[model samples]
Target chain A: MPKHTIISVSDLNGALKDVVEDTFSDLWVEGEVSNFKAHTSGHLYFSLKDHQSQISCALWQFNRKYLFFTPRDGMKVLAHGALSLYPPRGTYSFVVKSMRPAGEGDLNLAFEALKQKLAAEGLFSTHKKQKLPRYPQRIGVITSETGAAIQDILRVIQYRFPMVHVLLIPVMVQGPGAAEEIARAIYQFNAQSDPIDVLLIGRGGGSIEDLWAFNEEVVARAIYHSTIPIISAVGHETDVTIADFVADVRAATPSNAAELATPDQREVLQIIANLRYTIKNRTLRKLEVEQERLRNLRGSYALNRPRMMLEEQLRRLIEIKRQLLRTTQLQVQQARTSLQLREGQLQQLDPNAPLKRGYVQVFRDQTLLLRANETHPQQLLTLRFLDGSVAVVVNEVSQDR
Target chain B: MSQRLSEHTFSEAIQSLEQIVRTLEQPVPLEEALSLYEEGLSLAHFCEARLQEAQLRIEKLSLQPSEVHPSTL
Candidate 1:
């Protein structure tokens, strides 16, 4: 011991540093963030703490933008980075490269982040929603085959509308790859020729983690973009998911969705029967009223007096005949008077009447001579009296003295 | 007119039946208008029978392919 060499302070520090760097480098840690501080050098410094331990952490500015959301104090986070020793303080710390919100424990933060991102993309906008059919011919169901939800839906639909067809797209509602399977099934059903009228995407009640698939962004986006109207029936009445926000309608349960899809067949039948009865009764009442109206019309004076109507018509005919006779007689008398006057005027202007008054008409070749100018000298001419005619030769022509 | 009536398509038949019901509701004596009333009643019965037949076929369709069950409902 007395012969051992003395060690320098620098050597001691160097050896210790190498050991600490080797021990701390290339490690991952998870803890709640606390007392976070940002230095002027553009580096973030914070302590990652569990109930039992705590470690200092630093995230440089280069790595900050990669974080999808902001970090807050008391936020449980899983950080991946290398542990390094700060030589100035001779303290060991973590240099974080990437970080994410930790656990099912931080679901609220994840949900908020997802919700914000989806909202910014307009996934929950009203314009993206589709209207449900007023009368669905067929409904598609995506749930476990043996689940009570299916039974409930079937029972409700059968009771309400027996004619509606239900197409079951059997799929696992929980466990691995369930979300993908469900989304694919919906797409497949939509692509079919006789496509389902509406899609009921849901499951019975479960824990939040069990219902986590419905909360997934992929599932929500699928529902949002679905051409078919979706009725979300997930968990109990109180539980809601991202799927619910994007669905066209949200029902309290599977049975409720069935109720929404169908109208009561019995009630429809009853209504039809009632309509038939009302139609018959009203028709009978109308017929009775019409018959009574006809009877009343027959009892009227005009209808009852058939012989009087005929007699009245005959009397009118007689009056019209008398008027016609009077008009004809008056017209005939006027015509006769006019004829007599015309005949008298004719007799006064007649050459024959003049002949009858002791004057004779002279003719040349059966042509009557109207004046002395019409006669030619030395022409054979015929002279006609009222009842006698004579042929004569013109010996001399003379003008009237 | 008879061929046209006979050639009535499914939707047209329904429409004609409804129209007949509406027309029958007007004031015509049943005894005096027995032929028209009989025609209307026959049309109504025919429509109802067609619907019932279709319903029966739909009931047959409702039965799952894997199992053969009574489809009374």
Candidate 2:
């Protein structure tokens, strides 16, 4: 060892800072955060600790802008940066460049925690899910512009329902501000005066880190509160995000999302075709039934042989006429019999008939006496026979009782 | 009649045509049946025309980056 030489504290700190920077730079440290403080100037100051020891960390505004989440006290994080030192105080700290929740398990744990929280809030409830339109005329898409997700969606939509209007709201699917972008896009769509029927929000296959934006609370809440039905297709069939749980529908792929948004045009066309055929067939069948009824009416006796119907009526009329004549003849015979009987009665009462039966009538002058009480005592009388009449004078003055 | 058909969507036109067909199947007067037949035929034609004329339209909603910044979060 060399002989001791006295030196200033700054000199010692500078030497220490250089050694720490060279050795600890570009290393990762995982620990739970405590005493976290965000300065007014946008700098974050915190401590990374374990059960045994702890270290100070400072994240400047420049690096802090890239953080996907706000670090809180007791949050376990994996920090990337180098060791830094303050020479004046002879203190050392970590100058963090980037930070993430430590480990996939931690992320999963965070996901589970958020899911449970939102579930308690009724965000993932089935009753909250809106039913999609049967035929969505206008479809809104939320995804990256240059990704294969959009291409697949476009292809599937074109092939299935060609008439739909697709409005793509391109967004950053992954990055610091991606979740906000997606949520804002959804709000923008809702804000429009003319609303889209449904929204397809998704991306192609990717790792969890690549799909972290979709798992964000902002995105999940946006999907949960959306008035428009959302079909979440975050990744391949295996990848599940919070968005999927909160969305109205979960599609295995972006193409399937598009398919779910609209009815198949070909199938609708087939239905129309079948309806057309049915209408034609029904109309024809109706016409056939009517025509058959008309034919039966034309084949009836009254229509086919009108002359025969009239001849039958004429025969009935002739029969009625003959019956009337017979009735008249019977009436005339009865009248003749009655007249003969009356004539016989008059003949029986006739004095002329009695005279012809040898009975005589006496009359005085022009008057004839019918009873003794009606005769005069002294009067010229006439004796009339059936053939002659004679006058008798007062010789027969004595009245015969 | 064409303007009316233009106002109808594919589903609406099909539904109307179906209604007309169902009514025609009942005991309708000849004049009403003939008119319903004519209407159904035109609706069918209109639906077919719409299906043939329709084309998929894709549009991009141009959003400014500053308008949707994560600072709002």
Candidate 3:
């Protein structure tokens, strides 16, 4: 490389940008705020200074919304962001993604770090969330008995779902041993011979320091490991704590936690009524189906009635009448045919039948003589013809021989 | 019919009643439907009795620091 080589200011700043951002990208800077100004575009421009040194800082609109408090000049704050450089101006600055007041700033950092660590361990996973009971008979509350949280929970539980027992395990909700006490209370409720349906562990609205017990790792771990579902209601709606993430449910207030724990009596009544309506309708439908089946069976079997039996018999009788008519007609036709045949046969047997044909047959008395030997000589005989009768006399009778 | 729910809690009774009603909404054999209706009616009765018998009992559980269970921490 040539020693005299030169580059544009943008190139020099660009080279410095990579070094600054990479070295100090993820770090927190503690200093007094100076020259704090918020742009109309929601970007925040400020300077962080100590007694000896100062640095320009910028908070983007995207990160400004995450700050719980506004930064003002002369406020001691901890600003966390990546160091960035503007190539055009050749100026380096800290882009503050989050800023908090100095005293609780460390706590906030620890809170965020623990939250991420626990999240990585699956403590905040939805799969590990316990199901809340729909109709909770026993609701366990762990808060200071003297606090308004207990009173609020009790009043709400009694007013909404009176058919419930509130087992209040009074525990210190703040200060040094408060987290340990709350954790013990949760475990005590879990180990009881009789189980509570849901546990509400919280205090009334408070400042972050006052609600610090809920952010303690012990409390969050207890909430995570408890077999019973827990509703975290440590502070006001905006003040979210680690217990809120660990618990099965998060309520904005103690009263809200009670509301979540139990069902309203009126709603329960409606559910029961709806179930009754369904059962009634279903049973009625079943009976109607059975009755329809019975009716159908009766219709098919109604031939057992005397009138139906008589109608069936009448139908059979008409069929018999038709058969009789047919049989009688055939018999009459046969009789007529047989009578004509007999008449023809009788005509052929007539003694005078041959007389009309110029052939004579003699009969003595009333006897029918079919042979000449049967006739007597000189005997008077009568011969019958088809139309008339005649008397004849045989002078001689002889055999053909 | 109370003996049928002797072992059930109030919530269990209500849950059973809900289940019975849901089951009855579908097609079931006649005998099974009759039995389910009977069971549901009894469960409903049990739940109603529980509602009437309910008393709001609030008990404060005060434990000393030493009384706290050791394994709980």
Candidate 4:
């Protein structure tokens, strides 16, 4: 045997992998990206370059999903990954595990990152927006009380529509802690029992950094959750902020926002006038139609021939009377027939019939004496004959014996 | 009934007149049209009285926390 000892194939391969992987594994690299290509095979390939050095990198799809925004060429990024060498290609590369934005300033990058983060959370959905009242009874302005923006808004509102009550919620809109003050003002307005109908939040035209408070995530979220409709008038027409995106409505300027919150008196008057005219003309036409109808009805047969109507009623009355008279005559004839039949029956039963037949009857006073035993001596009595009357005195009375 | 109709407020009378006009404009039978026309005339008289009595007033709104300021124009 020579000085070197013989080794198995598996032991030699394991020893080579340990030397290659352990030396460069778990490395953090910072550089500008270039020649980046996201492969279809769920992996990203890019070259990390510095002024004097360059290294190839591979970020798989699993790691790419964690990135907040799309990675592009020439973007500065910090990547952490494991270093490895492909034996087949005989080239070294970094297999990235995570990455973050690098070149931009920390604040701006943080802002952009947070904005995209919240937007993904649906903090800026249009469906969450509320419509501003068409007619706001009270309008609240949240800005510096002495600012020209407030002046412009007030002037426009007072000039256009004087009916809207203006409420000024004074707050610092710039410098340190301005965002907190603005947010508190918004919440305070919300807590009011009878809050303003709409809130106008804005300032005059300014630089991006000057209006940064409105762009702050806190203020944007405050406006998002506000019960009152907010009209954002942060800057000029071209200037847009997160407040503008989150507000119910966005106006070009403070004056324009005020105009939106309060309707123009002239325009409203014109609308009322138009409505009045429509109502009047329609009503007049309706009245004319009704008058014509009435005139036509007055010319109808029922109204034209009053006497003919009376004659028809009289005819009905005469028919009813004839029916009544016929019924009454039949009832009377029936009654008369019944009376004559009753009279004949009475004549058949009459005791006076015997008197007319020459039968004699005796009576005392107005009483007929039926028995001789009823008479007493010295009793004066009147006798009634059929054709003559006589007076006599009863002596001794006796029976038929 | 006519005096009661005359007592209607401005908006009430206007609204009623609008209703009447709407009813009269419909394609109803002649008998219904005649009755509706009669109603429309009474509404028109009420509306005329309201307009005659209406006076335009422009007043500044009182800025209160709770009070609702009416539309001036």
Across residues A1-401, which tens digit of lDDT does each residue of candidate 4 receive? 56988787666656665787898776768888899998999789999999999998999887665455556788877676788866545567888876655554543564576578768888778899899875565688888776889889888887876656677777778754465567666766776786578999999988666676786656776787789999999889987777888899999999999888876666655544554555556555656777798999888786879777888899999999999999999999999999999998888787566677876666777888788877788998886655677888887877778
Preferred candidate (TM-score higher): 1 or 3 = 3
- Candidate 3 residue-wise lDDT, A1-401, digit = tens: 66897888878888898888889887778899999999999999999999999999999998754465667788877677888988888888999976666657756765787688778889899989998988876788999989999889988888878777778888899865677789888878888888788999999888777887787666777898899999999778898999999999999999899999988877887777777778877988997897898788777746458777898899999999999999999999999999999999999997566777876554578787789887777888888656666899888988997
TM-score of chain A of each: 0.49, 0.56, 0.58, 0.51
| DockQ of every candidate structure | 0.06, 0.36, 0.35, 0.03
Instruction: Identify the runs in model 3 with alpha carbons over 4 angstroms from their true place.
Output: A1-102, A299-321, A337-401, B1-8, B22-32, B35-39, B66-73
Best by lDDT: 2
DockQ metric, candidate 1: 0.06
Q: Which is the winner by TM-score between candidate 2 and candidate 4?
A: 2
Please give the ranking of all candidate structures by TM-score, highest first, separated by commas. Answer: 3, 2, 1, 4
Q: Estimate each model's TM-score.
A: 0.47, 0.59, 0.62, 0.46
Q: After superposition, which runs of candidate 2 have C-alpha atoms over 4 Å from their true positions?
A: A1-32, A35-102, A286-401, B1-8, B21-30, B64-73
Once model 4 is optimally superposed onto the true structure by TM-score, how far is the C-alpha of residue B59 displaced, in angstroms?
A: 18
Better of 2 and 3 by lDDT: 2
TM-score of chain B of 2: 0.67
Residue A361, candidate 3: C-alpha displacement in angstroms: 15
Model 4: residue A337 alpha-carbon error in angstroms:
59
Locate the minimum summed-lDDT window of 10 residues in model 2 chain A.
A392-401
**iRMSD for each candidate structure, in the order shown:** 9.8, 3.5, 2.5, 9.2
What is candidate 1's lDDT per residue for A1-401, written digit by digit as tens?
58988787666666767887788665657799999887898778899999999998999998774454567799987677877765555677788976756656676677677777778878888877788875466688888787888888888876776555678877778754466566766666666676567888888898776776677655776687678899999888998877888888888888898887765655545544554565566666767777898899888787869877988999999999999999999999999999999999998988778778888878888788778877767899988888898899888777896
User: lDDT (CA) for every model shown?
Assistant: 0.71, 0.83, 0.81, 0.71
> Please, what are the lDDT tens digits per residue for candidate 2 over residues B36-67?
88888888888777767778888899664446
True contacts kept of 3: 0.52
